[model samples]
Target chain A: MCGALLVRNPKGGLDRPIALYSTALILLLLANIFPFLTLEIGGRQEITTLFGASQAMYNAGMGELAVVVFLTSILAPALMMTSSLYVLLAVRFRKSLPGVRVLLSWIGHLEPWVMLDVFMLGVLVAFVKLGNMATMYTGNSLYAFMGLIVVFAAASSSFDTHLLWHKLGIPGRKT
Target chain B: MRARDVGLASCHTCGLLLHLPASGHTHCPRCGTPMHMRKPNSLNNTWALLIAAIIAYLPANLYPVMTVISFGKSQSDTIMSGVIYLFAHGDWPLGLIVFIASVLVPLLKMLALLYLLITVQKKSHRRRLQRTRLYRVVELVGRWSMVDIFVVALLAALVNVGAVATIEPGAGAIAFSAVVILTMFAAMNFDPRLIWDYQGEDNG
Candidate 1:
């Protein structure tokens, strides 16, 4: 279905995923380091980093919810990008990298679990809802978060799973 | 010409077309995933998960999702109440968004799944193409329901203050998340190919 769309380039190979995953990894780091948003009310400011959202839930006794938030928004995406880069690098250099097939399988399964885009919308809703009560400020991490979303989407679209499996030379059953 | 009729099976994980072994169970040689003619117990699994989600949907809507306490004033909001609050305060776009994602999507998705399950079970041949498309839509929209859960989590995390203001996640958030997860599992366990399975029966 994807190949049918637009012009198919014979040479459109590993470069897009490699570049996008690298950029995504950097953005993921930046998103974690800087404050994501700040809520100021009555001369006091509550600063929340990207991790803070889940941390606060844990603090509030919603440990399960906190874990869900963390896994979907943080860990899943990070692992996805990292593993994709690993796979792409291995494929690009034509190295017999250890566990390449397993990693590819994991990458496929992990795709649905990454919910950064949903979390981004959550951030927007939080902003508007919080806007009614307190003064809100977007931190530097917000930009990184947005950029990560775009790059993640591009990387997912450009990374063709069929092509990768074919290139890996895993033998299919003879019909 | 369905795959199963000719003893051919495709690996769901890696999309590799392969012949089914005579033993009736095998693994995908390329991706190492277990092969099945169709997802095993697709209907039963989907029914179980869909029922659980439907049960969870009650408390998810009935209970408060979050409570905002400011200056000794405490106000609790359920999913609908939160959207109404947003709309009341003129945040129409965000309210509409919450309404669609939180309220409409879940309810409609469940209904659609229920319809698909019943249709497939009854061997209804009408609109096989549309039924297949509906399953795809259900799978696609499943994740967006997490928006409300994340929104509540973010608020509970960010709006922390000692005395001036604080937000606490309510019991409903847990139930709501359960509903979302169960429905997602329900969608995944569903086999869209069952819709097309009726083709051979209708002509045979």
Candidate 2:
């Protein structure tokens, strides 16, 4: 027999993930729009946005690195957040949208590729490394990016895939 | 007997037992996901991805991962040099963390996956449970190597102080990130159920 494990969502169910995901979406927007970090030294000032870093990498002739940074830090997170919102909202409205199953599967596959939390930690480490070299100021995006990490983690943990499958009318084989 | 031996396979997306169809075009009645006894062409796909990752791993370690320019003097550091710099600077904990996440984790994961691929191909029945656990560990820790890429991105973005001090991503970061992503895909393509497939033959 092919044994399959099924899990039930704890108390509060999908409500927590919905809230966290909504907040994460907002934070992600802010993270993209604003400057990510700023540095000043020897009377020269430089500002870099999230997208700017990727562009800078591309300009520096590291096209592949730019794509990696862009995809993991930007594209993957956006896809995860939006697809999750689409599924969670559809389930909330008691509507099984077309491709809900496909979307859900994409969310599962994209979870690890989304690295906002790791990127946030990277920002911190960069700050520590650059502390003595020059005057460094975190831009608004840094704070937003940090918030996105926490919110994304919370949203993902509380997201009950089993509950979603059930709502989609998938019969669960009880172990 | 293994599940496949009995012509039954479980839906990976949903917990539904599905009978393997003769033509193998079955779909899970419950989840709507296409059902298969094992990931189709798992070994071939994984081997291709693993080879690509191995090729990337060389430049990932050889070239400078990041460049530091301070006071008109620029210095590029490879991944190993960065780790050594951290340790030499008395930041042992962070050094260790970087070392494990960037260097050790990817290396170990590739080796583990290589072992699994070889054993499954050989139909080795030894340590089936342990091999399954090894796959799980490899899948779990594969993403941690992004730590190095993130560090590069963050520093490059934050430390753009012109001639005073600036950080630029080097070719190594690209290759390194490719290794991490490719290995992850390789792990995902590898089906753990294959580990148990050899058990019935051993018993017989």
Candidate 3:
């Protein structure tokens, strides 16, 4: 009972930010699900997907790293997208969720670290490194990943989570 | 449990538990009265994760987290080298980001935890909001810290050249991942309650 956050006005409606973000999130999901990377080693061409990346890591003797990468980058984003979409669907239906205020706040807190941008950074870094070593080709998956970065960023920026609780029928929650 | 027991609290603006002497100013600087001093595991768990994250932080920074062995001579690249490589190759902005998010950010976050724990121990009163914000920043940014590792995983898979070059994550990657996870937990376990505790009141 030490500190309680107060929201003076909670009837704020969902706007462009919400719609754009929902669309972006769906795109991000497609980017991850379809293929986030491709494998082309030793002339044995194989179009490896994200799941294949996990297998690649394990083969490279980095099993733990594989799991962590899959969990946070692969799995967590999927979960976040699904959750946000569900919330948007609920909002569209004009349903009220108890404690929607707290949920939106939690989402805000979690948003900044989603890190798809960072992954893109890594991709660039890897391309540089691989370029120095050998003939490194950028795959279609990487292209999709490039698109994903924009989608993820747009999703994060355009999502005014403060308005989330409002659309959910809980007014006075945007603190 | 008695209201009278809790009534010893000083003011409304800042919660400060009033001194028993009653002669001195026990009111809060901002919001007076009953500051929440009690945190369930303020020092213990913070210290534990702080130490673990610290331990994990060393190998994370020092050693080559990802090594690409190729064609007789093996070349190992640490996170910094990878970032530098990016910068030198005309991707300075991206390099700086990876350096900051993967290297600098994680280190600062762990160090901040250490600072917070120590200050909490010393009962130092100051900049509680800033400290809390710092914690939030670290907590939120921790996931981004995995970018480098993800890159390694992605590349090691996508660009494998068989005998020419093969990428493998080294011991440093595990240690770094541990640091990231431990620091994340450290942030979580850190009761935001302590911020107000130092400011002055007892949290019920």
Candidate 4:
């Protein structure tokens, strides 16, 4: 296990995560606001954003489903990005915020629960399934969601928890 | 003869190993976050969450996950029906993906959690390393079951062409999502340290 730990460190730095996280936040906002997928059939069209989709689910009597979707796709990701920004910014300023370590740990826990990438793949599968039924056009939010996935991935990969712990002056290193 | 027996407890948040204070200090001095020798109430919490998941799993698989209306006709499809529809339409790969991710993953996750909880409660030392790996696998794959819910949300968001076609989420989607999320919590609440507890005595 110690040998595995020694080999686990890949290249990561602070500057890149800050940039990527900022971009991810912007894209996340866009993804939530704008319509993600537009369906046109028989002269009627409907546009839906991420939140709108969850709302639709709730309105259709799947309230728990809506809550799950809303939490995993929107709430978790938003929390992760903002919390990451908070921690990374504190690190950049060379100040140990009272909750910096706690926030970082929360980010580690939140990372897996955020399902933006998988949600995007589901969008694609939905598109293919709906293709024969209606004329579907990809919306701006779809593009933003795609970008959010890439940017969020970049930010998370660039986040080094060990380095952050060291910067925060947490003692008794295992390695 | 656990690590705690040797007076060592690793910080949960920062991975720092420190002597277990005789006074039972709860906060890690290094990180200022609460520390525990093993997760508190691990077995009871896991068992509660697992039972909840098991209850939710029945309705999740039984009811329709979504309803699709097209050209004056409405049809509701259960998760199994959806997978079958995909397979019948020759989209076997997507069908298989959905089957594994939405169905298999959650069921397997619950079973794995149950197994871990049982073994840890019994303090079984056999195959300790493999049991630990299984716990890791359960933790890692727990989130993937969200794929089905995502698909439902996407389809419900899209495919809203009015009379020509519309997709609406069904009650089962919510139930299925509950099962997935509850199982995830169960896995998180589990303490893998318990898997190694019995082994320590033999090794020492």
Give the per-residue lDDT of model 1 (tens digit) for A1-175: 2111323443458998898889999999999999999899999998999998888788889898898899999999999999889889998898978888888888878988899999998998898888878999999999999999999998888887777777776655432
Top lDDT hit: 1
Candidate 2 C-alpha lDDT tens digits along A1-175: 2333346565677777888899999999999999888887777788889898678777777777888889889999999989998999898887858877789877777888887766765666566666666778888988898888888888888888877876777546532
Score candidate 3 by DockQ: 0.34
Q: Which ten residues in a row have the lowest lDDT in candidate 1 chain B?
A: B195-204
Sorted by lDDT, highest first, which candidate order results? 1, 2, 4, 3
DockQ of each: 0.61, 0.49, 0.34, 0.58
User: At residue A75, what lDDT does model 4 achieve?
Assistant: 96
| Ordered list by TM-score, greatest first | 1, 4, 2, 3
Residue ranges of candidate 2 with Cα displaced over 4 Å: A1-8, A170-175, B29-32
Candidate 2 local lDDT, B1-204, one digit each (tens): 667767888777765677888775588877677888889999999999999999999999999999998778889999999888777763688788788988999999989999999999999988877888888889888887888888787677666756567788888998899999999999999999888876756586
Task: Report the error of model 1 at residue A124, Å.
Answer: 1.0
Which one is best on TM-score?
A: 1
Better of 1 and 4 by lDDT: 1
Q: Candidate 4: global Cα-lDDT?
A: 0.82
lDDT (Cα, tens digit) per residue for candidate 4, span A1-53: 21113214536578888889999999999998888888877777888888876
DockQ of 4: 0.58
lDDT of all predictions, in order shown?
0.87, 0.83, 0.64, 0.82
